[model samples]
Target: MIIKIAEIEEEVVFSGIICADRFKSDYENVDFFGPVEYSLKIGRSDKRLSVKGHVQCSLNLLCARCLESFRYEIDSDIDLQLLPREMAPTDIDLELERDELDVRYYDQDEIDLTELIEEEVILNIPMRAICKEDCKGLCEKCGGNKNLNECKCESGRDTRMAQLLRSYLEEEGDGHGGSQEKAIKVKKG
Candidate 1:
């Protein structure tokens, strides 16, 4: 991901990088691994500097249903101006803003873009991972892994009436099944 200063002449550079999922920060939510690609273009024109490029890559994720790994690829683009590190225009008695496309410095002259790519990829990851688009998740009873085994753990309540009653109350408040008002009605009726 390092580009030498002398190479910016209207030519594009293509390269590959190993995107460690951990580097994505948020990527640790789901275990994953894989490769990333980047294409960069850099050049300068008087007081104006240009940094235009894009990145593309894929990542492996664990399927929530089967708990297996799968690949998900995505792409991103970048077009930006190169600004001065932290010097002021007034200090130089110049008309430009204190933080403009730097008549003085450039990014490649200092900062590296490795961190930028890692950030974009993590943001692009899918919120949910399914081995197959329509995978049947695990069975909640008998501790069975639905993708691998079958169990007689009644797909129904399979619990004592008292336990089911407690669970019903808990789930009702969870805002998924029905509201707490419905739970009170059920208890009374």
Candidate 2:
């Protein structure tokens, strides 16, 4: 969607493209349908190419533990000062950088909106997807989903330090009063 600065006054949906987004795995259906809402503003110097807007989309993702799919929303704000590719100013203060391409550039009279909108959607995907806040997930011992039904596997959740200390006491048998001091030291440590 190219928003020309000279010919825009009201807020309008100039460009809306629903792409496959295969480069990023946000949607599994090969094509995640969405839109990008943008508008143009004439700058102080009467520049012909300045645009700002927001992007939003939603899709389903499968949880790793439970193997169930759920909904995920992709929403982000975008504010970019569009500039002609040849007129883009070179950043003189970029550390460890030379005369290299910095960001997405546009032609003399038009702008490409696909790249920026896709970037926002790709960055919004979470690292881990869960069905619910209190998802029980699968049983550790047996391969079974704990959300739907209970498992016969023994409880292996041994995160208690006190229980481990008691087991160590059973092994040491309080020899010469050294174990008690060691236990206190361990606790303090």
lDDT of 2 by residue, 50-125 (tens): 3455666655666655766665555555555545566555666542132332234566565545655666556555
Off by more than 4 A, model 1: 1-7, 10-14, 18-34, 43-53, 79-82, 85-108, 147-189
- Which 10 consecutive residues of model 2 have the lowest summed lDDT? 180-189
Off by over 4 Å in 2: 2-49, 87-89, 92-104, 156-189
Candidate 1 lDDT by residue in tens digits, 1-189 = 555445545544545676564455565545444567777666655434466677776566665556656665556665665555543245554635533532334454543557656655555555554555344456665556666666767546556985578556544433532221121111100
Which predicted model would earn the best TM-score? Answer: 2
lDDT of each: 0.53, 0.50
CA shift of 51, model 1, Å: 4.4
Once model 1 is optimally superposed onto the true structure by TM-score, how far is the C-alpha of residue 26 displaced, in angstroms?
A: 8.7
TM per candidate = 0.49, 0.55
User: Which 10-residue span in candidate 1 carries the lowest summed lDDT?
Assistant: 180-189
How far is 117's C-alpha from truth in model 2 (Å)? 2.0
Q: What is the lDDT of residue 87 in candidate 2?
A: 57
